[model samples]
Target: MEKKELQYIHSFEEYVNEFINALIAYSPKLISAIFILIIGLYGIRLINRMVKKIMLKNEFDPTLSRFLASSLLWALRLLLFITVISRLGIESSSFVAILGAAGLAVGLSLQGSLSNFAGGVLIILFKPFRVGDSIEAQGVAGTVNEIQIFTTKLLTSNNQTIFIPNGILSNGIIINYSLQGVRRADLVFSLSYDTNIKTAKDIVMKVMTNHPKVLKNPLPAVSVKNLTDTSIVLAIQPWAKNADFSSMSSDILEQCKDAFDKAGVSIQPYTIEASK
Candidate 1:
């Protein structure tokens, strides 16, 4: 019994000595890993600051630059972590494999977000629309307030804010009303079938041409449109600056109504013909 006890204690002492030796052998590497980690952290910060300065010097877009900086920082940190692990004599291949698998799973889960980010990059690169532009997309018409990495913000006419995913926004139909600085208002007015068509058209044309907001360069004019059973359809086309389009439309209609009444031309409601 005494001999068996002595053997157990002797083995334990060997293990303890071996462990101490291993620790001693690993100390230099451990210290170097820590030192490299600290130095790498400082270097990362320095590189980040330099990159920010370059971006600013080049007048890069603020949101895109910030996002890029964050992505670069994380990527550098990951590389540093791998390097430190490799220096510690731990098998880095398995660690990297685990990280790759985890990254793939995370990427799969965030596919939609990734798509939005790609769309945002396209938008920022091409600049199809800018902030304050009036755009209609996905049946929503509003002024673009902010452009983000995953979504774009819009302010509607009623003051409601809409967050539209950039993925759909970039891929979908977008009508930018303010891009050309001018918009055409298709105004349809109905006149009594019996009234003289030429006279009524002349009156509308005179009113539109005289309006300050209406553009005469394209030449505002009235023309005969679809003829209904009860009335004649008159289409008044006017070009105006984007900011004045709404008010100009309203004013032209009101002023035309007064002009029509004074000229003794009868006005009637537009009637659609039934299908045969």
Candidate 2:
């Protein structure tokens, strides 16, 4: 019984010694890991602040600045996390391989969204259109309400909200109507064929020239554009400030009606087409 007890105590002592040896071996790795984590978190915070300052100094859009700053910070943090794991006596090669494979799969799945994100970034950086600007893009015409990372929101003339993907907007032609400082309002007036064309043109041109919003430098255009079965069509192009376009249009149409009546120019009747 004494021999058996001594043998059991010796085994326990050996087990304790082995455990201590293992712990001592891993202590340095644990310290290194803790050090990496602390330093990495500090570095991430510092980098985030620096990026924000740079973005602000460059006058980047608020949304864009926030997005870039957050993305960069998180990316740095992720790298630091991986490094910490490596310092903890972990074999990171397999983990890195797994992450690479997962990333490729995710990238493929999100290809379209990524494209839109990239396009949106380009739009924000280049500034093709600003909020409240009237623009035509992706076959939609409206006032830009907001520019997001993946999409653009527009308020239509008819008060409809439209959402267009940034990829389509960036790839296609963007017609910024507000950039010109002024836009031409195209007006077509149809008069009875029996009425004199020169008289009709003169009446329309006179009305356009008298409008307060009509620009005088570029000169208003009034000419016969088309001859239909029942009437002669007169085209009137008037340049007005962008903000005054709607007002000018309403005023011009009302003034033209009065002018036509005074000039004895008989307006033609309209016909509706049936769609098949």
Q: List residue ranges in candidate 2 displaced over 4 A.
A: 1-46, 61-67, 87-92, 125-127, 271-276
Name model 1 segments beyond 4 Å from true.
1-53, 56-70, 73-92, 269-276
User: What's the TM-score of each model vs. the native?
Assistant: 0.73, 0.74
Residue 70's lDDT in candidate 2: 70
lDDT of 1 at 101: 100
Model 2 scores a C-alpha lDDT of 0.84
Against the true structure, candidate 1 reaches a TM-score of 0.73
Task: List model 2 lDDT by residue over 1-276, tens digit each.
Answer: 699999999999999999999999999999989988998898889889888998899998776687688779878988987899889867789889989999999999999998999888889888898888999987789999988888999999899999999998898999998987888888777888888877877887888888899999788898887888887877778888999888887788778879998888787757211110
How many residue pairs clash in each candidate at the backbone level? Answer: 0, 0
Error of model 1, residue 184, in angstroms: 1.3
Q: What does candidate 1's lDDT look like per residue over 1-276, in tens digits?
A: 699999999999999999999999999999999999999999999999999999999999776687789889999999999999999998899998998899899999999999998998888888779889999998899999998889999999899999999999999999899999988888888788778988998899899989999998788978998788877888888899989988898888888889998999888844412110
